[model samples]
Target chain A: MSLLGVENVTKRFGGLLAVDHVSFSVPEGAVFGLIGPNGAGKTTVFNLITGNYELDSGSVSFAGANITGKPTHRIVAMGIARTFQTIRLFSDMSVLENVLAGRHCRMRSGPVSAMLRLKWQRKEEREAIGKALAELRFVGLAAQAENPARNLSYGNQRLLEIARALASDPRLIILDEPAGGMNELETAALVNLIGRIRDRGITVLLIEHDMSLVMKACEQLVVLEYGKKIAEDEPDAVKQDPLVIEAYLGSGDEDF
Target chain B: MKPDADNIRKGAYAAVAVLWILAPLYLDKYWTDVLNNVAIYAALGLSLNIILGYGGMFHMGHAAFFAIGAYTTAIVNTAWGVPVLWLMPFAGIAAGVFAVAVARPIIHLRGDYLLIVTIGMVEIVRIALVNNVFGITGGANGIFGISSPSIFGRQINGVVAPGHYFYLLTVFLGATIILFSLLEHSRFGRALKFTCSDEVAATGSGINAAGYKLAAFVIGAVWAGMTGTLYAAKIGFISPESFSFWESVIMFMIVILGGSGSIPGVLLGAILIIGLPELFQGLQQYRLLIFGIVLVVMMIFRPQGILPPAPRKYPVDKLEKQEVSL
Candidate 1:
């Protein structure tokens, strides 16, 4: 059985169809990639999966449970976490607190216990903080943990967003445009990070415009055009798929 | 230095509590009356802070809760001869309950609409208190002969005088500050701040926005009601006239000037808004003008108020590896 599955998902904004009858299933521990041209509804797919946008029609199942119409937080708690294309960190919050906010779903202390800082709550807080620190370290951001999230460099901010999502201990992680703007060295580092995430047994579905990074990091790739999946296959195969090559490389009528 | 801040804060609270408790032993009658008013206003300002500062609910109808508490205490005490002390909590709870009921739907409105609704709520409450002539409410003239309850085996009515009441008010105010301080630091407090800063993000993170918002409304209402009890006892009289639009404005000014979301800032704001007017009563009408100028200057120069939220820090030692995309 697929670990995460979407069947015939269709999203519409008025007369415009953002994603039309798109269906895909990701097996547990697979590093999957969703790629497209600029207007290919890639981020829209992420939104549909993460409950950030309501689906006009379709169904989403995670871990064999129907999650269609579930609120974002509930979806997150159900072991699916996502990072945004824009990197939405709590700007005024501390680096650690941003992670703690994600860990909010994991906390089990009663209000009264939290108030009195009972032994259990204190221990839990310390443990959560430790976990947050570990996640930050996992993303190579330990040195900047004490600073406000907004003050971090743009790349660190993106890393912080990923760390925050990871802190939720998701069964499946969706990263939207994880490598939208990065140099060669940074893309290489992201390839390693994606590998580490998969090694930890978390499935990843990432959207990317950077073909090199996506092709290197993703074992399987799906190509979308005008809100429809044009092709899906192994990276090497998809690269040569006539539809993908024609749609993405622009029919080779011009530059190499 | 690690322990010094906590110690100083505790010391400040302790010193204030002691001074107020022992004040009747030394202060003259005139000073006692002034102190009583200060206590009442301080309590009112603090309660307003819970809503505006901590909960991020901007309420201009807080004085309405104060009016409700005062009226509840007055009616219960006068009609049934119940001790004012026993009636205080009941009044506060009653006011809180009313706030929750009315605000559940009204709080959905934001900014100008919220301001209008709250202003309307206060006016309606005031009118009800005054127009209910057939009912137990004394109307425009107000409730009188309302007596204070006994404490420590002595009837604390007109006998020990306003000075004793001043002491009681101080103790009540101290307890409130401590209670509010704890509430602010709790998960509830954090949740409220999150909701205030970004409701969408907060709700997306799994917080029940409606629940937190309603809780803030009710908690702030209860605080307002408690302050009313203090006012009723301190003055031994309350006309509908006392709880007015201007009073609500005064409370809002205190919270904003002090800095919303900061406990110490609210207290400091309360002192300035309440104490400054009293100290400059000789300035009379011009005193209000001066207060307005001060508020305007503060808003223009230091919009974050006397104390902004302290920045939170990340633990730098936790970074594992750097991945630069560019």
Candidate 2:
């Protein structure tokens, strides 16, 4: 059985169907890519999978449990975490605090424990801090930990967003445009970082525009066009698929 | 980054507390009264900080909660003869509950709409207090002959004297500061901060943004209510006229001056606000004019208030730390 499965999932916004009967499965420990041009409903799939929006029809099963209509936080608690296309670090907070917030779902202490600063809670906090620092260091941001997230350069901010998501300790991580706004050099670094994340035994579902990065990094690829899945297969094979190529070229041609 | 020196400063605060607690013994009644006023104002400033600073609520009706607390305690302790100390928390609960109810609906509105609603609410509460119901509240005459709080069937005002009241004030102020400090550092507090910074981002992070805002509002109301109770106890009387829109504005000013979200900044702002006026009693007529000008200038120059929130630091791992060095 697949580790995370989206079977016949559909999402409609008012009169428009944003995701139409999308069905796919992510095999355990697989590095999968979802790619589409603008308005092709790539993000809608991420939204549906992460429970940011409810599926109009069908279901999402993670670790063999349905999480279709669960709240985003509940999904996160169930070991599914995601980063945004727009890096949403807690900008006012320090880099470390932003990641610590991701640990919210994992925390065992109640308000009373935090308020009283109990020994057990303090110990747990120390451990959590150590982990957050480790994740930051892994993302090459350990020294920038004291800086406000807003002060970080764009590339570092993107990395910080990933570190924050990792702090939640999820089994499956979804990165939405992880290389958005990065130059070739930065994209190379992100490709390596995403691989490191997957090597830690976590499954990855990546939505990206950088075809080169996706083709090189993703073992499997799903091509989406106009709210429908046109093809799913090995990256090389999918790149050669006529229907997938047509969808990309067709949308661009039709726009004119 | 080096460890924050602020952490060490907190230790020094404890030593300062020890000294302040003992200094009242050497003070005369006049000085004791001034110190007492400071404690009361500090509590008031702390209360405002919870709402405007930490909660990011633009409340113009905080004085409504303050009025409710003061009246509840005064009415209960005077007419029904409840002991003064017992009256405080009960009054706080009454005001807190009122705030919770009011905030449920009002908090839905954002920005200027929320501000107008709060302003209207304060006006309504104040007018109701002034008008009274069937003469029970004495209307404009206000409740009179209120007694000082008592302990063990003896008047605390007499037994404890002004010096003991200072102790009580210290205890209350200390506890309030400690409680708010813990709240600012908690997960819930972080949720509130996220909401204040970006509501949409906070919601996307799986924080119940609306719920956190409501929590901050209610908590701020409770602080105001508790301070109101203290204010009534210290003065031994409260008039509806005293708890007006200006009173709420003054509270907002205190919070704004102290750097909207900084605890120590709020306390310092309160001292300057309350202290500056007292020290310049000679310029009493022009005092408010000068205060308003100073406030405007401060707003223009330091809009973040006395101490804007500083960026929080996270621990760095060995690799990233080395990367920075390179």
Candidate 3:
């Protein structure tokens, strides 16, 4: 009944074993968090789930359909959208244009209809623009819609990426280090945005190094270390788990 | 003040249109013919722009499509006696079909790899024509004495006046520009731009990157084929030499030097690269050297070209003021 179910997923890059037997289930409308140290394969898990990489073993099911080894774009169209760890805006495009590009999956007008500007195409385009604007407004970027994406500040660019993901009308949205580069204020804003995104009845899954944002926003957490799951529990319990602490601070007598 | 600026712009555009319409009357027959060539090249440049400029594909074999279109016209006209104008659309369809067939297998190749493969494709097509693969290509010498095209049952031979061909080319060029302008602003065009900017991000947005790339190639090929038909009709002859590898190179240069993704820029590029050499006929031997120098200088100075594409804008004045005050 879960929206996304990963069963014994394993991926190896030669002998590295980037992800080893990772399993988790994300319930519908839940904000799930994946936290890990550098090279802990959190991003690799995301890549596997999004079909960006082929899994060595195990299956992934989204919305009750097996999506194992499906192409990235097809997986995205099947109600799952994601942002990158590093920002990947169509930099030369305007902010609104970037969001409109995300709406590409939802629309069906091809080259001939587009070239001829059929009535239905125009109507669909107008609706798409309206929807894109609504998403930009959701992320507080409606005013900067006409500005080129590259011209926006780093924080605003991150928000634009979120808006773009939202425009795809996905059932579940994944955020990969959505708060990678931000001050306290920007991080706080991102947390609020994530909360608003979840409030819209869309499930949220995020990978974050910002402990405060992750702990505040995620309803449940999964911890990984050395490509293996260390702990999976509520935020308060995961924060206090001995394995999670050891993974973050190392096994030595290091300061908390 | 805005209205005055608009008026000035309108006036300038009107003056240019008037000059273009009156050119054949004032210019000599030789110069009129050169203008005709410019129009043809402009159309060809626009065609290549759809792939190289918008789709961000390195298509170094566009001349193959051109040859396909020209040969289809030549063969169909000679055998079936179809009116050259009526056959133009079929020529475009033939070239588009050929493009889909050839580009399907190699559309996955990107950047310089695709470039190398396309260069080989052009050679393959050229050699096929030279060998007269179908016997209908007329071998290396090509077909000759093709009938002139007629609009509304009026023949446009242009043998004596040259104005007839000039008008026809201008109409073709104008129509091409209009059609391309519509496409450049549409959803399909935006998809091509997104694919060009970042293929991975575009795919993540659910764009079939390969499909859009193929569409761009086919559209570009269709345009090139139509231009080839026009070229054959104007010359009343066809030859393997007309659609050479160098011809593809010139079309690529026209798009790049004019600023890729800019419609007006490509037209200007066609005029400069095609028209300038003709104007400097007195310095005939140094033409290639001069072109090289000019290209190098352009690259050093205005690399984005004479008219780089401006940012796209939408008319959403009401929504513009509704920021959340974040």
* Best-performing candidate as measured by DockQ: 3
Q: Tens digit of lDDT per residue, candidate 3, span B1-326?
A: 56675577558657867888899989999888888888898999999999999999999999999999999999999998999888899999999999999999999998999999999999999999999996889999999978899888889975655788999888888888888887888889999999999998998878888899999999999999998898898878889988889999999999999989998789889889988898889999999999999899999999988878867768667554545221
Query: Over 4 Å off in model 3, which ranges?
Result: A253-256, B3-14, B318-326
DockQ for each model: 0.30, 0.29, 0.54
lDDT of 2 by residue, B101-169 (tens): 999988878878988999999998888888996566667766765666665766646123778777778
Global local distance difference test of model 2 = 0.80
Tens digits of per-residue lDDT, candidate 1, B123-206, equal 988888889755878889999967776787676653358776776777787777777766665556666777776666665555
Q: Worst ten-residue run, lDDT, model 2 chain B?
A: B317-326
Model 2 steric clash pairs: B259-B306
Tens digit of per-residue lDDT, candidate 2, span A53-121: 878899999999999898777788888888899788778788888877777677776545766878887
Q: How high is the CA lDDT of each candidate model?
A: 0.79, 0.80, 0.90
After TM-score superposition, the amount by which residue B54's alpha carbon in candidate 1 deviates from its true location, in angstroms, is 3.2
In model 3, the clashing pairs are none
Candidate 2 chain A has its poorest 10 consecutive residues by lDDT at: A247-256
